[model samples]
Target: MRATAEPAIAVTRQLGRFIATSSWLDIPVDVRREARRTLVHWIACAIGGSTHDTVERAVRAQLAMSNHGNARLFGRRERLVPASAALVNGIASHVLDFDDTQLGATNVHPTGPVASALFALAEIRPLSGAALAHALVLGIEVECRLANAVFRHANRGWHVTGAVGSLGAAAACAKALALEEQQIAFALGTAATQVVGLREMFGSMCKSLHTGRAADNGLTAAMLAAEGYTSADAAVEGPQGYAQVLNGATDLAGVVGALGQRYEISRLSYKPYACGVVMHPTIEACLRAREARPDLSARATAITLRVHPDVLSATGKQSPRTGLETKFSVYHAAAVALVHGIAGEDAFSDAMAVDPHVSAVRGRVRAQPDEAVRKDEVHATFSLPGETIEEHIDHVVGSVTRPMTDADLERKFESLAGEVLGASRCGRLLERCRGFEEISDAREVLAAATA
Candidate 1:
């Protein structure tokens, strides 16, 4: 007989121990470099999205709930309690749906929950840059591992970012606070029990709420555990535990096998377009097709896309009526990419969604699911008056295989944040993020990020 697998509880304990014991020196150099990149990308997103209508509404809602604390909001000059700060900043970072994504074990947005919770805590306390980076990596590890163990959680209708993100936030907060192993375990338990997010809420204000709540819930969990709050030690793998209750089964071995040997941050992918990652290939194909044949849009009678089934399942909205819904519509992505030649934040607005020309083009676009097509690859065929132009994208630009370089990331940051912080301040903030480890207080970085 084959040997039995380890219990889910073992995974939780191993993760807690690793977070409690690991230091900056324990992290690999490449992982550390990626951690900084992740932080900078997240901060830029948070700042750039701060002035968004969604963020404005969230901030207003949070302010109504509590108006007493001193944690800074990125890109905006507002103060809330650590938990509220985490909540609002998390929402802001993800409102545009442009945050960095990790596509290795799970497709969770790794930076939002972890960075939001950590920065909130840093503002309340005085955490050094090294400590903050270490915690950020540890936090991502815990959440991404949990995501790997429950790999199909998203397919099951849970937004994995919010579902697994709370645990990541808890881990990062616990590490930043220097929690003991037991405390860290308790923090995980608290976070695991309170996982929040559902795919039904996607493409709405509620979707951003999931990320905000994950950050808030995890920060709260860590704070509670730090005060000696007790929780189930086997919260992750126990009977009726997080994995069993939420996912029916868990890959405990996958969660614990390479605890510190490999870091999940290394598998991160930054989005070049402000839409679902699955739609990127289609957008790239459309853009490339447009570039090769500039008159393709005017000449094309129909556009057909062959893509992975998951692409349509995730982003198949035919007539997206709102900006938020447009982010999930692959048809809109393709249409805009072909018509406007760009799918940046400016391309996914309510106004852009309702544009007659864009609608005309998107109406002609059809996506057919093909299991043979890889998720990162797409085949787009544009039928003109007589001729057909075909574009095949085997590797999407933002995938790990074709990653955005540091300079590419900086350009993306400048484009997004320059509007909010102006060109000079955005430049300064980028420098600060690149040298985050040398900072004495992590809050200084947060301060510089704001307008």
Candidate 2:
């Protein structure tokens, strides 16, 4: 009689088979629909981020340092090395701070890993849009499952996205390569050893740097696996393995539980703004207050924001001098949104961040955690310029609760893509991604994006 496989072995077998066999058609109709949405969301973020000076500098720096030959940079035809391409593209996807966020698994960002890996592969392979979308599902599954295993670890000191995301990147790359079960298992196993990041780097560019490293390392792992690099198949759950060693816990079953049934990618939150996810609600509040109290500038004495502890911890930028700093600073974003009635790409610019009037308002804005408010909720009360005008924001306007309409997503796409690709190319890119599953070759779609 055949013996039952160990849980780790069973999980590896299941994940390998799932990655090997799962396709767009196998995914539920609703999931396929959401996957398309996620594609649009990630592409918008990448396009929006491509214009950031920081991303440009990083891309150029990588090109100068690395010897890898030319690979396509997102939003442009300029080619850098594969690793550089992954770094630049990954940073672009997350730079605008407008990528999709997974609420469960402690609100980890999902697109960075999948998009970063897939784009690098697209530069070399013949992957289809359907295959890319399916890879996203598998990548998100890997990230969320690993994150779920290490949820407590993130609290202890790890950045779940960076740490678990490395493994996610590897899994997605492996799937995109169509690796065999043993190869996929080994890739995950090898990637477990490479996982690393800390929450201490949250405020700096280094925070996003973690995602870049995950994409790079993940691609490396896939290439190594493809080249016959061998790793222990049970790296995730072996004695003193990834779960116990890195996370201080183990849950092989949880990693594979409801594997085919429950879908995490379908539930991700696509951002409508380019600031921190925690700052979105505050952005909405400031916009609302600006609309309501046009003359309250003199009346507004102070603005108080009651937010979740996590938000305060994650996005509480006390004083921002640059757009990047402002992205991490709730105080800056809230102040700008209320004063200007909008927080667009330019809102976080150095000119705006250093504006004396903006600084004055930012000084008055205070973010504190209140247990009564939901973790995702941002309640804002404003003291007006003429009279004290107060509003309680029950939720962010463009959140999953009050999602951005398809029209809103289109507008966001146009705003981001048009900056680099022009309106016509942007429209073509959006149409191609929306109908991604039907494309025979993804390069044609990618060509449209940059054409």
TM-score of every model versus the real structure: 0.97, 0.91
- Please write out the lDDT profile of model 2 over residues 1-451, one tens digit for every residue: 6353443445555666677776667789888888888888778878777867767778778867874665676686667777777877887787766777875237688779767877788778778888888888888888888787667334677877788887888888898898887788778777778876787776566767777778887888887888888887667776567777776665567787777787888767777677777788788778877887675444567889888777777777698767778887889888888777768778877798798877888888888798677645777877655555666777666666776777788788888888889988888888888788898787776677652
lDDT for 245 (candidate 1): 83
Candidate 1, superposed: residue stretches over 4 Å from native: 1-9, 152-154
lDDT of 1 by residue, 5-85 (tens): 446347678878888888788898999999988888898889888998988988888889888978999999889888999
- Model 2 Cα shift for residue 231 (angstroms): 1.9
Model 2 / residue 205 / CA error / Å? 2.7
Best by TM-score: 1
